[model samples]
Target: MDKANADFTPIFDGQTLAGWHAVPRLPVSRAPGGPEPDRTTETYRRAAQTTGSWTVEDGALTGRQDPPGCGYGGYLLSDGVYGDFELLFEACPDWPADTGILVRASALGSQGYQILLDHRRSGNIGGIYGNGIGGFHGINFTIDAEYDEQGRPIGLRLEDPATTIEPMTPDKTALLNDAASGEQFLSIWRWNEWNEFQIRVEGALPKITVHINGVKMTEIDTAAMKHPSYRQDEVLALLGPQGHIAFEVHDNDPGMGDARWGPNAACRWRNIRIREL
Candidate 1:
């Protein structure tokens, strides 16, 4: 309430998906070099045939892959575009769901700055990810989920080195200079419950800051950071000064031991409020 302190507005109506639309989740990882892949037509086609399901149930926006683990993913994006704003929302995802909140997103939901809400086994939350902008990860640690015999999520573990794919080295640490420790995040995060997320996105090339349950999680300055694959000029041109906000339902990879999204399970969102700066 304090950071995004005043003049807040509600983007979601709590009854329907009126001011939002669906789009296919596109490739967020691209190799450095060559002109950006123009997937406009492909994005449109996939959107028309989107297999993800979005609905408002009990006043909470719920999203899940249709037919439960059909390997399809999509994003529900706001119809209006915004620049330099503060967004607050509460999310409660089922175990094993790879989801996120995307800011500065293109119409097709291909490109954006993402706040990772990867609520799955050996996944992480509140991290900064470059969506279709070079695949840079700006986070200090990882989180792993513990499940009961019935396959329900029981608890969470912090910074499991064995499951880490991108370790925090000197370079990574320098790039993500304002990262919160894993223990700091774990101490505040409430498992299997509705957790509030507050995000501040500003500037042409944004400096994004994320807070979970009122605790600062991480901050990334795209304008100042450098990555092997990230091109600031290219991203600015592709996304422009303002764009839509989107929620993602990640594609299920059947090869993985568990579905990226659970079977018939949905991630719930509510109290989505925003304040434009």
Candidate 2:
């Protein structure tokens, strides 16, 4: 394989997690228990008896959740913090899963810019979302300003008044897509197919830009975005210019009788390499 010319570095060792840590899927409890279990056992307990695992297979960093777990998604975070960098990786999902590349995350939580990988029917492959920022938190994405009937952005700092967001065209130098469902955009992405994702983070508050299979999706000037749920000060705090990189291991919703966490959602990530700019 060719190198990124020494600017980029490979983080995953293809077989082990030497410099990574897994955050507790759920908060620690003071429940009545027998002789505080070991850290690993405590984690499974925190996961509400459901086992979500991150491991290396086929030279990739893979995260899996089984038993439709009882906790929220957990992150496998890097031990070090990063700021002003470009990250590239490939992700493949086999089912309806919510996956993200977390950059500039705060400590152990999802406080940062997320490259949303909600590859379901109505999900987007390349989009900027604020993690743990109220209205933006936990939702697929954030929307503050309303759109006109023609999808023209009503109010945004960087948007032009004449054009709507839809029908957006990238530079002719980039690849093209045909639909919003992500699958119709190109053959590069599909269930179980490896889709290359590239993310760039810059500026003091960080302007997030995303690309999938070499096509630009959209960009978010974090400091300039407005939303009803969170104030700019609140949102600004969540955008960590220096933080860890992580892969989210999703938790299954425990429901029964057709309301289950079924349809089995799972994703795989590989070739996770990054370079600071």
Candidate 3:
């Protein structure tokens, strides 16, 4: 049974890569400027040149890539699995970079649910993305805002309208279009600065909610809908009970050899904490 208690604990020590593992990664088909897959965990650890990189600096957990855009970005997997819990962290991404948090994420190449971290004009931040299954299953739920240390709004972060090319239901696609024009979301996003990120997931596919700066951005109820593939339930089942939490450095051919891994590919995270409810 799931508990309702809230006792958060630190996971990363901020000094080492303990309790984390790097999964082997390579570029997807037809992507250029990306390296080949390392083939094994050991091989990934031993390679002089890493397609993706992870490090601890200034007490922050950082994941980085090079040459931006070209292929698939790398992933860092947790040593443990979690379900029906809340996660808190700070993420700062360089514009043009791609990143996200994977829940019940599988090491088998994007097989899980993702919380988008792309803050670009064509990206969806604080949105639902289907890993290995495809792209966004739902439209973005939060608006971007820029604030200062004093908790005052400085400005708003906005993404330009993007053409929909992913396989999505007509209704959902329309929803995305409407959302892009709606000022329903508030932006608290800051460039090259730390931003608070929180996620509350509970009740199996019961309820998943995402927040930025304590603002509710997106929510999903698994029982209310199903993926068209007829495997979303099965996949969620595989994730539930318990599954790994992960961070992704995305690498894909956005267009014309533009790498998902951009020049400022160093995405930093810190103050990791989690607790089961």
Candidate 4:
């Protein structure tokens, strides 16, 4: 990728990667209660155990597939945490893989908001995960009981869970909005090809804007998003200042025997970059 006409200045150019350190890879299987590995070794170990495959080449990061027992592929880091910043990166998955850009992550716990990148046929892409929440795939709404002039339940309603919930279509453009109100900020699609992702984080009010080949897809209201048994404020607080970014690859095919151990099923990431807003 060329550096010309770049919106965000290049912080760590691929030519001479400075301030970025290469984390080592570690063994997948370890005996119970074994002596813990060194820092770099442990980082690689945790990544392999969690995401399945990740590698670096020519100063660019890439993810690949390894057997389930070889460790899950992803990044496990003790660095790269920011608050109220903008993150820009390019991701292209070879197969159906779920990748994410995480911010304000907790160093000691799995508590934070993740901008998901999933390519499944289902409309589950570009949602928040973790921080005591499992999944909030798309914009969902619930309407309180309507009241008439006599304070009785009215017949008219809008955007209700029983009948008003709908998924926003994908558009390739930037969007901005006040998080307090549930507004359509962005539309996202898991394109078959590479797409540029722009994530703007303004403290607890994080917004996600996605574009594909210069076409606007979607903008999501991070603060207004809600899920069952989870509070947005609590998750944001736990994210703290900084944390590691990772990718998640899971075995979805259940027909094949030992599908988890099968080959030809893995995810990859490239051209990763972040700019502090």
Rank list by lDDT: 1, 3, 2, 4
Candidate 4 C-alpha error for residue 36, in Å: 23
Q: Candidate 4 — worst ten consecutive residues by lDDT sum?
A: 171-180
Best-performing candidate as measured by TM-score: 1
| lDDT (CA) per prediction | 0.81, 0.58, 0.62, 0.43
What is the per-residue lDDT of model 1 for residues 28-80, given as tens digits with 9 covering 90 to 100? Answer: 44633455546577553554477389999999999988656666778999999
Among these predictions, the greatest lDDT belongs to 1
Point out the worst 10-residue segment of candidate 1 by lDDT. 28-37
* Higher-scoring candidate on TM-score, 1 or 2: 1
For candidate 1, the per-residue lDDT at 86 reads 92
Q: Candidate 2 lDDT, tens digit per residue, 140-193?
A: 122122357996434312223244222223421122222233223443444346
Clashes of each: 1, 0, 18, 22
In model 3, which runs have C-alpha deviations exceeding 4 angstroms?
A: 1-6, 26-51, 66-72, 134-136, 141-157, 160-170, 173-186, 254-256
Residues 1-277 of candidate 3 have per-residue lDDT tens digits of 1222347777888999999987745432111122445556543343324446788989998887643332445788889888778998889876556688888776543566777886543456676666654333566432333568996445555533354233224544332212322244443555568888888777655466777766666776555545454254555655555667888776655362333455655788898888877
Where is model 2 poorest over a 10-residue stretch in terms of lDDT? Answer: 171-180
TM-score, one value per model: 0.89, 0.68, 0.74, 0.56
- Tell me how candidate 2 scores on lDDT: 0.58
Write down the lDDT that model 3 would get.
Answer: 0.62
